[model samples]
Target chain A: MQKIVPNISVDCVIFGFDFKQLNVLLVERKLQDEKTGETLIDDWTLTGYHIFEDEDFDTAAARILKGLSGLDNIYLEQFYAFGKVSRVDSPKDNIWLKHQHEGFSSRIVTVGYYSLIDNSTVTLQLQERNVKWFSITDLPELGFDHQEILNKALEKLRSKLRSEPIGFELLPEKFTLSQLQKLYEAILGTTYDRRNFRKKVLQMKYIIPLNEKQKAVKHKPAQLFIFSRDVYERTKRERFDFSI
Target chain B: MQKIVPNISVDCVIFGFDFKQLNVLLVERKLQDEKTGETLIDDWTLTGYHIFEDEDFDTAAARILKGLSGLDNIYLEQFYAFGKVSRVDSPKDNIWLKHQHEGFSSRIVTVGYYSLIDNSTVTLQLQERNVKWFSITDLPELGFDHQEILNKALEKLRSKLRSEPIGFELLPEKFTLSQLQKLYEAILGTTYDRRNFRKKVLQMKYIIPLNEKQKAVKHKPAQLFIFSRDVYERTKRERFDFSI
Candidate 1:
């Protein structure tokens, strides 16, 4: 028997960028009436599970993410904790949750953990649970206050992106500056002056320009640049800010 | 019959500054032998409690702070959550905790909340709890992973002090640039070039200079300046970064 903390859970909000739009990984859950064989609830929710008795919150979040993506050492962060009393009180979620957990009748305080991933980097292996990535702007009606959780995670991501180098987590190892700008625009939901944005970002010494360009494209291949973590680590005194 | 969540708690690390040093608010707990009436254990810990089932994490933190300080609308933020399996398993803390609660036998995951206050602003009224301010550098042995929690909160405060104007939370409404510099030095545990520090901070338009001067001082009194949140709010687009 798997012992778990019945009143606490860790919800992992995996955000991925496919070089176009920002998306979040969610799982589809469908509950059917046992006696009448009718669909009672069919909705999407964040990937989460009750934390094990022996696991800390971070460990629980990592375990859940690793189980879904089969990847290790992803950039995971615990952003917020959602503990609204009526968060899980919806009749549909209450009925659906009964089919999932053995004893989950009480309120659950879920620690919200999020990560940014380049969609091509990881091989998602939870198709059996119907895990799919939904564009952040066109999200379905999520269950159990997960929409609020995702919004909070996006807000945090936006704030961190302004002062941190976390936006590279959503890009390939070698990316063009246009790709970087697009990723920022998608997450922040705003457009930036191309010249101004590039001027400010290129000043950061850590964005090392590689003597390389795109392989194949319809337009002119822009120069490629790699975010040098080594350079950043060496000169960590410099604050990474691109509020332009 | 005060019902609470037995396995979840909120710990508040209240940080205050008195223009000389940074301090943390702590409460003392003592355990005594039942028959002999001899003291078994005595130690300091953060002000916290097992959360009520009806309360959210932020609400619980604010309630605990208000109950202790009798102050409303102080700056409070949820920093991190400490959920180690052995966090509350210390034999000494376990013995002392038994007297405080009816059933706290299981592992408790505590969400760490922190706040900054000007020592002169609030009237602390928890004399009976042996609540006192201790300098961060010279702290007593804290109980049950609280030392680790305090260390983490200090680290967060240091990082925030670098990029945000949260340092103003520790000063009086009208303060000199020298006082602001001293507050930053005390929190970041370093000294700065006086000329450079003032030059950088003076450029921030939000720090408005008033036609006022300090009074009742032995030496030459400096000019007084107030942190204009109105100006900050009006031109909030400018990122507040004081890495100098």
Candidate 2:
């Protein structure tokens, strides 16, 4: 009797911020058409994989992240699953499917996870040939419903930012309130009254104002601030509301 | 060259309320020990599978739900991905490793989604033997890391309940304030201040008061109310702060 096998896998769309715009990492596909034995034009996509039998889903995502980006110990959170029947346009067009003797089309049920990382920490590895970063706003036409995945990930990231101190991950260790507000505005896709935003931030008492000031801005320099990691940890662990 | 197969699949844990406690649907695993060639005694688990090449992930989940419980059109949402190394204990005892030809030890990654369904809608399919509902608080040891997955799903559900109007799915069409409170308390795993909770619910203006009163309760009969689906949809779509 044939033993049952599970066909499942995890994919990660690593999103990074450079204080200006949102960006995502993508890898170019090298698959060819099976029937015509013709190499298909290269198309960029997210780094992904088939879940190894011995590995956990998270481990697979981490491995892909490390393998493609050469970065580890970064925060990765699963956001959504793409299971639309027509997710992949044609099953027989890919090189991966051509190798299977069973002649079955590829039905990929991918769980998309987004990671927030400071762009400076990212160093390309073997992915240099196949991977590149595209601004979330100026994305090239993608192959799959990756655009939808990115949108959902952005929504989750915004929700996370509202409730947690995850925005700190997108910024330098020390920054100004102006920079902080800019980051929030970028993520929220809307502007907030600077005075109100600052007042709200100060009331939270989670961002400690530093004695230093930013040196390079053209206007009056703003005071620097660092996230109160201790307070954030305590409040987050206790489930305190951080909504603004 | 051997063809690489892209397999798709879905796994679901159906949660139901049993009047006094929350419960989950589970089934038994039929696989035997690989190395010892001995059947493992009484290992129960969640319903899952590999997706057909032509099917979507949501369709696969729906199919699994129907196949296992004979329920259709239930409210199911994709939750977190369970990906950790050793999520499935590998290194099948030495005996199973010896029969390498079987490939039973190949890695499988599963995407876990969950649903909240009224217990009355459950119609078990005779195809499954030993199918039963276990109280979420009193679950037996499950296969793999399913217990952990179930816990994460519950946490997600709780968080979702606070942000979204998912309570409508769990409660009957017409429910008393006390019944609504109990449902919230059960999912949140906390004791809510009844007066304060009621105050907040009423302030939302999304609960339509009815003339009918709940019968047979020990306290004074509570007024019945139905959720305003239109208001809920408008509020949710407008992205108003729904934090309670």
- Fnat, model 2, is 0.35
TM-score for candidate 1, residues paired by index? 0.89
TM-score of each: 0.89, 0.80
The C-alpha stretches of model 2 lying farther than 4 A from their native spots are A1-10, A27-43, A49-55, A67-69, A90-105, A120-133, A237-244, B1-9, B28-40, B90-105, B120-128, B216-219, B237-244
Off by over 4 Å in 1: A32-39, A123-127, A190-205, A209-213, A238-244, B32-40, B98-101, B121-127, B190-205, B238-244
What fnat does each of the candidate structures reach?
0.25, 0.35
For candidate 1, give the docking quality class from DockQ.
Answer: acceptable
Q: Model 1: clashing residue pairs?
A: none
Over A1-244, each residue of candidate 2 has an lDDT whose tens digit, in order, gives: 2222234446688877777777788777665566897876556667776665456567677888888767778788888877676665654334444553343335556678788777755655453357777877788756566667878888888777755678877777788777788777777777878897778788666688889988887999989888877876665432422110
What lDDT does the true structure give each of the candidates?
0.84, 0.69
Write candidate 1's Cα lDDT for A18-111 as tens digits.
Answer: 8889989989888778899999988999999999999988899889989998887888989888877788888988788777767874889999
Task: Give the 10-residue window scoring lowest on summed lDDT in candidate 2 chain A.
Answer: A235-244
